[model samples]
Target: MAELLEQRSSISLQLIDALLEVFGEFNQLNIWSKVTKDDFTVKRFDLGNDSNLCCCQLTETAKSKLNFSSPKDCEGVVVKFLTFGDNGITDNGLSLADIVAVNTVLSINQISPKLLFANSKCYVHEYIKSRIYTFENDDNPEVVKCLARILAKFHSLDAPISNNAYKTSQKSYEDFFNRRKHIYGWGNTEATGQKYLKALENHPEIKEQYYDEFAKIDYHSEIVYVQNLKERLDSPIVFAHSDFNRGNRLVVKDSKDQLEKIYLIDFDATSMNNRGVDFGDYFSNYRHREDFANEGFPSDEDMALFLNEYREKCAQIFGTEFLDKKENSLEHMIDEAKIYTLGSYIGGTFFGLMWYQEAHDTGKGQYFLNVAKNQSRGYNRLKKRFIEDGTIPRILQMPK
Candidate 1:
């Protein structure tokens, strides 16, 4: 316990140094009324993948002016620290992109936590009261509809960002495996790879059925295939929160209406892509991580419920007969989302590999191993259904 406390103390000091660097000794920019050395407490915010990211909530210890439960109250700031790799450079490009994405979301009249300050070492955001949206325990269909409306609002944005959403998604998929080549020893001499392989030796089927089969095809080709299909079907390219999983979603209950309002956070992977990719990404993450519940993935009826609201919301927002045209009807978008679901499952398999690696490193035993297994199983199940429905070719043929 002594060692642990010492390590935490060291981390707290480092974070304090970073914050002081961003906001000078006297808090010249007036981010807070007064910036005292021991006026704030630092605690890590346990959200998102912590492997490469560091998020912390710095709460003021002094008295505040507003009520704690009010939606408008901001008692603290969430800080995302920049992690510098072996190479001297930091992930500033991604940080800048995220900042741009946050501004874009705010521009659309959507709710994103306000940005207080930013620098190369860390960026600070006004911390809003919110809890991560969990799809399992919070099984309110109204939440689903609200999420759909929020997503439509996002997709309707003509944000000034790269239009390479498809390429971006595919690249993310590839990067996962490339990372594993070293982190989990996919094709390297790293000793950690041996440990990874040894852990999964008993599950030979995972390699033969999922990883090996998954490795046989190029993901870029798969992206191309869907891109062509979406183009032929008139799928609009719009701003998308490419990583719109449930964890990135936050909820706060309105004190007046008592209805839950959705707030989206995290935009490191935002880009202009086919709207279906966002839907696919969102829908594929329905299952709970702990139990790996299968029922979490929305049913056809649930999809219809969400998509209908989305279609109408788009029509309302754009002031056109949006998606009501003969070619681009609600049904077509539903089918398109379904088609994109295949890509999501493929991504899920890659996520499973990542989870396994994280688990191995943290000595979490077979907890994440089961997560990987369930992910591969989910992907195969969805792929089988798609193949049987004649939605896609049995083999994801490389684009010519």
Candidate 2:
């Protein structure tokens, strides 16, 4: 046992060393040494236990290797190092890297040059602009144009084959959503409602009201609704950034209030899926349903202008039929978006419930559970809107 532990320790050190070698040195010393140079300052942080995976930032000296001039308002390049445990999923880093690469390509092609670097232990990405938080508030046309262009670019990337080293095939949208359901052991409306009920039982004050609303749902009625809708969706699969929220996107504006550039970050949840899935994430993450309903979701005028611009750009880059199916494309897209929205809610709730349970054991679960409950309420509200707006019934009409 002693010898085995020693071997493991040695391997860990070697991994760290390998990472440093790829990232290069910080000043004259190694990354760890440099960070700990001032003992008193470093003592306050528990860097070693900051994350489940081994992670650290690259020093400015190390970032100098990229040969970029530091902007007056810019922070230095930050490289995050992470390693999976023996039982943990290994493809996470690679998937994230893929998203970064794809997004970088799109941004550079349509906007300006941005760079992404990665090695086995870490991924490094740099953006010239500030991150954009809410798309609704961002009025920069260039930013909007760049976003649409990147989405088109992302859709054009080659789908992962089963034999690829990165296991892109495993990153398919269907696989991801299905795996999510399996992991949570909940399916359909009834199971989902029961799960919410259980979550409420654990946190009555935060979840009771929401649970009551969910409990009133008619699960059997939604069966035909879901089954019929499944048959109508025959859209071709494409590469999608499964988590294309505004948080993952960055934007830069000119003095005239025109968007100069936009950058997409955090590709950890990217995968091949329907375009509607990407749009759903975009809408939910950036523009909450309440905001959309009150203000009118993206406005028909904006959607029309954005779609026209997106289709034109995509046709130039890929082909004329890049967003084909002229007759019912917009409606189909909207329906798909609704599906993804509900799907996100269901998936998020399950994970939140699990985190709450785990947090309870560690005495830190209430906050996370509260977040889940709130999100569940939001999703339920959105679902109700979809039903009232005839969106749910339309999806229900889809073929299984």
Candidate 3:
């Protein structure tokens, strides 16, 4: 472990040295050191007192330890190094347009980390103002509602010049299906046709078979009048945080226990998509984290509370009349959320099981195998709940 940490530190130093070439005039203008010698210092940021996310801090002057006692400890320009092997870094850093949009949101109520510098290797941002407790992965209801309200405010903001909507997540979902299918040895061996294959030897109702009905659901183009007044809508797709996991939702509060600011970090997955994408993420993915002992998948009543809180927040920003459209789209949004939640759970479970059995990474085999079973149980339970509560329509009854 020490050797691994040493190697990581060595690599980050190399990256910072290389990044200096990109910083050029800004390094001096920003008072950031270009050399990794005595002047420049790099240390792994102990985010939330845990290292699940590898974050490193680079300082201009020699500062070995960053004081985290208070928000004031985080000062001036902060350069953070985020490396995701090879696929993440590109020849061009964060596009100027993306940075502008990120900043616009932050300007409102600290919806995200302010993007200060960007290059092919990583992003640099103003150090977020918050104490360690504020940034912890907490499951407090107030924190959850605060996060939801912040997201509402983000979506309500006037679009930035470079912030027009675009769609890539659906394609990525298809890619995940392909990768999980291939890893499980259940889909076509071809490079591009994996997504179309059907069924697993053990799980016949998985993949294509289970997803076909939901796949037919098209919110925008194919609109069917299921009921008057509450017709399913293709709600205006907006900028979405593709990965709004627990780790990314950081919060800041005042001495009065009032929520001050909640900072959304890690824009690596930022994209333009239907808001349902974010809803689905919070509902199924983030809620399952170990921190959220409140509820695994928040109960319908709890989810309703979240929606109500979000609607109230939206009403404040976009006006009471604005909520009518959201209300109309509520059913469809929940539908989208369900489809995504189901697919994600099943896909993740299958991947774990396949890795344990086929890939022979047996070191964590039992744990993953049990995780697969637990996920399956959770999925089945949620499926039953949805069917019973009529949160979603009967499987074969919906339009094919």
Top candidate on lDDT is 1
Which pairs clash in model 2? 225-396, 228-398, 229-398, 230-399, 231-399, 231-400, 232-399
lDDT of each: 0.59, 0.50, 0.50
Which regions of candidate 2 fall more than 4 Å away from where they truly are? 1-19, 25-75, 84-113, 127-129, 135-142, 159-231, 254-258, 289-302, 322-328, 361-366
Any residue pairs clashing in model 3, and if so which?
A: 93-119
Clashes of each: 0, 7, 1
Clashes of 1: 0
Prediction 1 TM-score vs. true: 0.74
Tens digits of per-residue lDDT, candidate 2, 248-301, equal 566666788656666565545455555665766665554453321222245435
- Poorest 10 consecutive residues by lDDT, candidate 1: 1-10
Top model number, TM-score: 1
Per-residue lDDT for 163 in model 1? 41
Q: Candidate 1's error at 231, in angstroms?
A: 7.1
Residue-wise lDDT of candidate 3 within 1-400, one digit each (tens)? 0111333445455555554654453544343434333444344444432332333344534344422233433333445444443543212223445644555556445676655565544456665546432223335677767777877876666555332224334444345445655663334434234332222223443433333332332211111121211123343566667556556665566889677877777665565656665776567654444422213565655666566677778789777886677332445556656645654455445555554455333456445555555655555666677767775454335443
* Residue 148 local lDDT, model 3: 72
What TM-score would you give candidate 2 relative to the actual structure? 0.65
